[model samples]
Target: MEQLNLLFEGFQHALTPMNLLWVLLGAILGTAVGVLPGLGSSMAVALLLPITFSLDPTAAFIMFAGVYYGGLFGDSTSGILLNTPGNSSAIASTFEGHRMARNGLAAKALATAAMGAFIGGLLATTVVVFFAPTLVKLATAFGPAEYFALAVFAFLAISSVVSESIVKGLMSLGVGLALAMVGVDGPSGTVRYTLDIPQLFDGMSIVVITVGLLALGEVLHIASRIHRDPAAERVKPNGRPRLRKHDIKKAWPAWLRGTAFGLPFGIIPAGGSEVPTFLAYGTEKRLAKRRGDIEFGQIGSIRGVAAPEAAANATAGTAMGALLALGLPTSATAAIMLAAFQQYGMQPGPLLFERSGDMVWALLASLFIGLVILLILNMQFAVLWAKLLMVPRHYLYAGITVFSVLGVYAISSSTLDLWVLLGIALIGFVMRRYDLPLAPVLIAVILGPLAETELRRALTVSEGDVTTLVSSPTTIILYGILLAALLFSGAKHLHRRARQRTGDSEGDKELIDA
Candidate 1:
């Protein structure tokens, strides 16, 4: 009841016309920033942290929260339409989202992403408002062993994309793991794969790898095939990209399920929204088979776009909650926000609410308001965004490459990164040509280090005993879940092969009768 009262007071502050204007401005700017490749909410917030010091703490936090949610919306838009994920969290959406656009469902994909993000953020934020402390405690319960198990879970969960071909999928995962090993090892203070380069000591940035492998790689692959496929061109959105009632109805359940995946990961240091979004995508694919949905690989299922978007934003909500309530940063953006808190002479933890109760509640309330504003900010301009495909194919891809290279270089202003990007882009082209999956590569790059570090920590604490990994209840549960997922995948594969054989035999019988 007291929380509810404080929430109402929060609304009182957030609803003021001045504060509302700030939310609107932040939402608009955030969406614009997110449309750029490799720039996400972390960049958006970092850029704002310095300039917004003039505003009072409540108003400043309100705007920042608005920008955070708004970035998710814009990130999805570009990921779906252009196959350019603005952030790693947006990567899962591109798996099906860009395919949906290629099938001339850009409007539907856009609507699904927007609505799903809104539902996820709204429910997740509401939960945080009421149970921030409890959620924080649960997230903090995860130790090194639990986090290692969670990393293993993420590796297996990506089997959704792995279903195309086991050999090729594993190959993609191996490449990611190799790239992840390039940095210096933390425990032994030894460099493994830096190759005597100073810049490589810190490791390959996810931003550069993702932008290169997805956006620039797509450009090169298409260029290589443009001669054979003379009609290769950007997909044009079929109609005004407005949200439809049917799309919302089909997506609400996915939104809810994705929210469930996102909420827990938000409070845990398990590599941000990437795992939940991938897990949500995998679960929806499995459910689609049960429902006999055929839109998956050929024409992109709406569930694919919906579930990942929801998970991403839901994680965003809980990340903000955990940051304010427990001082734990679950994402790169949240870590930057933690730094911003320090810059503002604020410390976030158990005593945060007591010291800055008014600002805290107001920031939470503004997050709710920000969701609505972002939906409008993105949806109203849908037609204009769709028109981006009107440019010529060659010019369009060239522009994308230019923007991507520039954005990547801006990260650390390194020429080495540009060269590495070209190399990764070539590798990506090869993988695409050979029918290898890209999602597993991304999943490994994101979680490989976490898995390595956690496993080492757990084993060292147990004095090199291998059993230390599975001794905990959380580890037991995680491994149990992984086993179940593998069993289900094997059954599905066998069933598919049997169905093909049966069809082939029937065709042979018909040929004999003829």
Candidate 2:
């Protein structure tokens, strides 16, 4: 009841005519960027961060939050129609969604994506309304030791577990940590890696680095591949995507299951929605009808598309809760939003609730509004978004590169920032080529300073007793969860390899017999 009152108060703040207009504008702009190849929520938010400097903090954050969710909802349209995933989270949707499009079911695919996103976002926001305060209360009790331990858990879980190769993942973390060190040492009040340059003294701005690396780096990478031939035909919807009775029957169960799979992981510090989406897809494939209407990979299982879409959006919502209440970002988009909060001179954590309650509530309210707007836009304009695939790749990537460089330079008219941008672009290109995950690097960069500060404070309080770090029950549980994740992931990989080898051996024997 009390939570409901708070939400009503939040709606009062966010439902104003001016705030609603910003919400609509953010959604439209975010969807436009999401439809464009190589442009994602992180880049979109980073590029727009400078523009928000002149706005009130609440309005700025509301707009930023709208962009974040709007981008997630819009990316699937590109993935389904063009086989070009606008963001990493949309990759799974491409698997089944593109297949459906090829079968002349583009309208169905778009409708499912839009409706699934709506369901996931609505439910997840409700969860946030009920649970955010409790999570903040729990986080408030965390001592420095507990906080340090939590940070360690985030670093390990995101980098090592999420990436295919632990070595490459660690390397990414190393690079981000190195970047974080470029600024002056907060503890010792001495410069460590600035090299005496004036801009180096202030260290690399998060805005400058993020825009340069993600936006500009992505543009450069895309430009390098512009000569390659584009695949997939531009799909146009044949008719309105009204769900048939059968389609609804098949999709609703998947939506519920996917939501169940995603909601739990949102609070955890896993890399992003990828894990849950994959798990949902896998589960649906196994439980699907065997002898029947359609197979897993055949005519396109509605469950395949619906499940992952719901999970992806649900993960996005839960992730927002965790970020606002706990100061943790589970994905790249969330990391960029964190940077936006910092730009507004607001830190997200327990204290944020006490100090900036109105802004927080308004942000949450805008999320609901954004969801409705996304659903309407996606269902009505999906065919139009699909037409974007026809744009020449060279021109698209070229424009991206130009805009990215301009956005970065606009943030800080510094030659040194351009140099830093070029350096990070090379690094990002290499990571992409090697198939190393970039989310972990961003996560590490965001959390590295916090970890360092908390560890030092814990040591100071405990007289250097490392055991004191796990004294709190929450910290101990978090560590245990981290350990379990490592073991479970390792065991699953080994088991999968063993099964593959066994199947291959049996096939070989049969071939020899034949």
Candidate 3:
């Protein structure tokens, strides 16, 4: 009941003219970024971080929340039309969404995606409003050992379980951990990897790392292939962006299923919406198959489009709750947002509600506002948004490169940062080239310090007793989950390898017969 009153007060602040305008602007820009391939909410937020330096933190975060939600809406647009998803989260949507477009159900796919996102986001935001305080209570009980255990679980989940190959993911994690080791040691106040440089004393800025890796690295990668990859042609919607009667029957149930699938993942430090979206897509497909419907591989199922999209946006919404309530960032975008919170000298967790209750509730209220605005804009102007693809590749990437450099330079007046940015961008290019997952790298960089600090603190409290690390029930449970995840991932990897080898052997025999 008290939470309801606070939420009502939040609506009062969020409904203001200036705040609403910011929400509208963020939604529009976020949609544009989402429609463009290789640009995501993380890059968008990183690039905009500099511009928000002079603005009020509440207003700035409100706009960011809008962009975060709007990005999910926009990514599905491109996926459905051009089959080029803006981020991994939208990859599932592309499978059925693009097929729907090919079948001339382009407008229907757009409508389904937008509506599904709206429903999922709205429901998840409501969850955040009521359950955030409860989550905060849970977070406050975590001690150093528990925090360390949780960090280890996050590392294993993202690096070993989520990636296509555990080796590549762990390699990416190693790079991030190595980078995290640079500069002054947190406990002893001893400089470790400064190379006798003054700028290295304070350590590498999160803004520089984020913009370099997500924005600049992506720009360079795209520029290198601009000549080889043909430009994506714009695909217009076939009709009004309204769901047909048949689509409504199929889509609403899928939306509910996807919301259920995604809500919990937001609390888990499993990286991002990709995992939940994939799960939702698979579930929908399995259900459709059980119903004797082969729309998956045949003409494209609206359920496939609906479920993954809902899952993606639902995860996006609840991810914010997890970040705020627990001071844990479950995705790359949330990691950047966590950095933003630190930039303002504000740490998220139980303390956030006690200190910034107004801001938290207002942000929640703004999400509801942003959802309505995004749905209206997407449904009415999807074709216009798709027109973004009409821009030439060289121009789009060049602008992105310019913005990345400018955003990084403006934040801190240091030539060393530019050098660091270039180096990280090169690393980012290498990671992308080798198909290494970027999320684990970002996760390691953000959580590495926290994990180390907590581990050291736990050891000191126990008088250097290593066994104390698992002395707590929470720590023990976390380690158990970590072991289970590793074993499951290993089994899955082996099965995949076996299937691939079998396929290859059959191909060889077929060739011999031929």
Give the number of the best model, judged by TM-score: 1
What residue runs in model 1 are displaced by over 4 Å at the alpha carbon? 160-162, 498-514
| Candidates by lDDT, descending order | 1, 3, 2
Question: What's the TM-score of every candidate structure?
Answer: 0.96, 0.63, 0.65
75-184: candidate 1 lDDT, tens digit per residue: 88778877888889999888888888877777778878888898899989998999887897798689999999999888866844445555676788889899999889
Per residue, candidate 3 scores C-alpha lDDT tens digits across 1-514 of 9889999998999999999998998888888777654455666676667766787988988888788887777677766765546566776777788677756577778888999999999988888888866644554567788878877876767677436688998998898888878888889999978899978887776656655676567666766766676543233346657777887988989999999978876776644776677667766765775697777746688899899899988888888999988888988888988998999899998789889999988988999999999999889985554444345556655665665566567667678888999999888888878888766676677678878989999999999999989998988998997798689778878998999999999999999999
How much does candidate 2 score in TM-score?
Answer: 0.63
**Compared with the true structure, what per-residue lDDT tens digits does model 2 show for residues 168-260?**
778888887888888778887888788788788777765455545555565566566645624422334445566789888989999888888
How far off is residue 44 in model 2, in Å? 8.5
lDDT of 2 at 31: 77
Q: lDDT of all predictions, in order shown? A: 0.86, 0.73, 0.78
Q: List the candidate numbers ranked by TM-score, top first.
A: 1, 3, 2
Residue range with the least summed lDDT across 10 consecutive positions in model 2: 229-238
Off by over 4 Å in 3: 1-121, 226-367, 378-382, 502-514
TM-score of 3: 0.65
